[model samples]
Target: MPKKGTRIVCFSPKSSSKSNSVTKFSAPSRFGLSPKRPSFSQSVMDRTLELAKPVITKWNPETTTFAKVTSLFHESRGEAKDFIKCVHNLQKAMHLLVTENPTSDNLAVAQNLMQISMRRLQKEFYQILSMNRAHLDPESVSTRSSRTSIQSNSTSDYDDDDEDVDEVRVAGDSIVQVEDESSLAMADLKLIAECMISSGYAKECLKIYKIIRKSIIDEGIFRLGMEKFGSFSSHKNKKKNMDWEVLDMRTKNWLDAVKVAVKTLFNGERILCDHVFAVSESIRESCFTDISKEGALILFGFPEYVVRNSSKKVPPEKVFRMLDMYTAIANYWPEIESIFSFESSLPVKSQAITSLTKISEYVRTALAEFETAIQKDNSKSIVAGGGIHHLTIDSMNYLSLLADYSNILSPILADSPGDLPESSESPAPAISRRFAQLILSLLAKLDGEAKLYRDVSISYLFLANNHQYVVVKVCTSNLKYLLGDDWLSKQEFKVTQFAANYERLAWSHVIESLPENPAAILSPENARECFKRFNASFEQAHRKQSACVVPDCKLRDDIIKVNLLRKVLPVYREFYNKYRAKMGNERSIVRFTPEDVGRYLSDLLFGNVGSRSSSSSNQSSPHSRAPQSKTSF
Candidate 1:
């Protein structure tokens, strides 16, 4: 009031305070621990207390000099006590005001302050009720859920200011009220999904997984990713710009999302299936974006989970596919020599090997393809002709788990005990020979692969020089019919030029153990060795037949020649007729024990000694010369 043009500024009390009351001050911060004034004039203090006296005069103590003491006691207890002298002086003025004059302006100011305090209290209550969690209703949920939905979709990274809004966010309902700020996209949703799974929001993760899976699959991007070969920049149809070849950002997000969710759902595994091939193929393509060591590790996808619902083993096609996935992983991540790196992570090693063990049920294609691919790849590398061994050997690690697979077959056969025909001369005995021959062929092929890996190519001339060198040791505690030296010499293989290397290496040194008729070695001797052991009941019948001494008669030899003709001439009947003699069924084909049978066969066809089969000279397979109907088998 003393300063002529000084403006009076009053700020209302803040909402955060404990109570509402009349507060007077020259400045709003007066009671708020502000710095002290240099010197408050006594006159100013006296005037302010005097000024407050008239306003507080209505409060009475109902005693003598009560009016005079009004300002000291009628005002707030704390303020009056702290400046009791100011209050005492004000009490004198209050007595004068009560007896003489009153200030209407003071009464008006108190009324205005009471109104301000009430309004503040009402506004605070409204806000508090609006945010109370338990107070939310279903209608309110729907109303607010829309807003929350919008916030969740918007990738704003959770601002603290959102907390004010989050309180109003009831699940299951809420309008998506996106503000002017930045928002998230579908791709962002995928990223969020990944984070949730990593941090163990299992429930949230599964929910997000379903959402993204539906989205990506509906968009047809999953199939697209699976089929799209990576490294497109190096492809024959290379796009002019790298951007053109790059996968859509959405595809990438979908993969990261689904992979994380799938991993979490299975505790990080997939059921092995045909789709796993595509999944791996997809992963390989994906890592082409960033082929760092970490990227390479991830590029090799996880083995899909395989479950056997029945007592029956996993199907061959499915098993083959699982093996394919292992091969793909091994081939894709070459920087890590062992993609599994079992030594580094026992859990990973255990899981991977366990996965491989499941594939042990079906061994044929898995073994053959794996063995072939490794040998081919390595040989290419050694000779400096083609691709890297890294590509093939990577596959071999998964394949090698099956080193124990073949033995599984042995027990199954032993437990079931399939009957062997009575004589090598029986029709069923031919079937046994064929089966043994097939096993030999399989061993030979496997040996060829192993030899290629071992770098045993000293020269072309010394091939087939190691036949009896234990190509395979099938241990039924060693009742195994091994590939003896005689078997290798007598039977010329239906070998490819590639396979001929092993044959040559194994057989060149086989002359030392060569028998005149090695085929005879296949049969158990009925003479001194096994008449009693063959079981006297069966042997007596054979002894009465006098089967051992069928000399090389012309008629028998002619019959054998005819049997050979029938074996080889189905496609060449025209040429066989030009030879202008005759052909007939194997007349002696059933006459003797298989041992004598084999002897008669060699002498008749190969001329006594130091000679090869007349039929063996014609070196060609149906594959090389012409196609034939395999239905004949």
Candidate 2:
């Protein structure tokens, strides 16, 4: 048999037989929605029909009984096609109808049929979606190439010389010849994303996105001017009039660029993030007249489109491709705005206040979603398709967003409502304990620096100031929507899962055993205790993981290495501070970046706080405080 949970029921009337027909055939729409209409080309229909024989044989060995009793259903693909062709044959006189032989009602009827057909096609698509097959996997885009059709009538393919005023191109002859010719193929990828949304092909959309954004890092285009919004349009009109390196890109190369961009950012590619941030800044400067510098920080590397530059006489669609590219790069993330950076554009004083405001907004959103998820138990609705089979992506994304938004709560509480900290004043909060206390709940399960959501995770530092927040839950009620049932339960250990469950055991065995609330004075002891627990957990998970026997010895070693956190003292301290920092704010928890893990650990194990930080000595939060013996976590 296939994997236990791998099988999905084939609803072909023949396989269902008489006893099962009422549930499978007569009851067509499970959600009260109309049956899905087939598409114009309807490429999957014949294929689905071909698949029916195998599926029926596998699921209903009693199909012979149906044949013997009655041939009531059109069980063959040819019969189904004949029925459809006959239904459309009446449209052959459409030209006569156009000549005033038909009433407006006739047009309306035709439109309804079209709509119904479309809807049925969509339904068929979703039926297949129930399987969550590899054809729509999130990491691979070419799984269904045979069925994925493209319009060949599109404009030029490889004209490298046409870098016109509106276009952009890279200086490469192989990808395309002219920078001016917009790639029909590249546009197809973007369109594919849009189509996926309509077709409920979200997983495929994500795959297309991965192909274009972060899968390949060397492609400078992915790292090109993203962090900035307006910079894309700011290219001197002379340059706009000049050829855009943007055009000469082949579909594969364009996807290569995008995949590289997102992959590196997710993989903690700090340098690439820096590059995206710079471009994001340029894009903003070109667009937002009243743009705040703080916005640059938060919005950097967020996936979005370049808006129309009215003053520049640019059409909005012209920026569509850029946005498409950016979207393709950053589509996996549901919430893509930069609330913190939006406000922190000015001095430390005002920036702090502004950051608090954004943090509040972010928290509000997250709180709402988290509450809804809890109340409705909507995991099933969140992840409905079989393609990713685990719609756990949203729940994990929402969880990480919760952690990030909760991160800044402490800082917000630490600052006085009326006054901002002075340049000469200590950067540490006046009431670190309260701040830590408030954030502890939010940071309870935080294991590592990054806010990963299990198999799918991303770490970015372009605008290191951003915080995440959730929008709404997957469903209003679990019964109403078929969101994943296991969303909330399984994601409790998001950070640890990303860390291969090492920190989970570490924290539970050690950190959670400590006081719930710790005073500043006792924080040092708590930190040590937490560190000890972390080490223990790491060792335990490490040993068990190492014991696994694989044909390749390196496989086990790699598994340990990939999941292991090299214990460095300062990393513990920063990790501790990050935990502490979340206590007061309880809303704005920053996800850990590799830099936070790498740099801080170096300082803890060795005294040197790398020169990479401009204010190495002035590290803002005092994470070293540790939990007091009497305090509760």
The top-ranked prediction according to TM-score is 1
For each candidate, give its TM-score against the true structure: 0.19, 0.17
CA lDDT of each candidate?
0.29, 0.30
Question: Where's the lowest-lDDT run of ten residues in candidate 1?
Answer: 267-276
List candidate 1 segments past 4 Å from native: 1-318, 325-357, 360-633
The candidate that wins on lDDT is 2
Error of 1 at 277 (Å): 33
Ten-residue segment with the worst summed lDDT in candidate 2?
A: 462-471
Quick one: RMSD of model 2?
34.4
| lDDT value for model 2 | 0.30
Q: Candidate 2, residues 174-234: lDDT per residue as tens digits?
A: 3433211222223222222222233233443333233333333223332443333325444
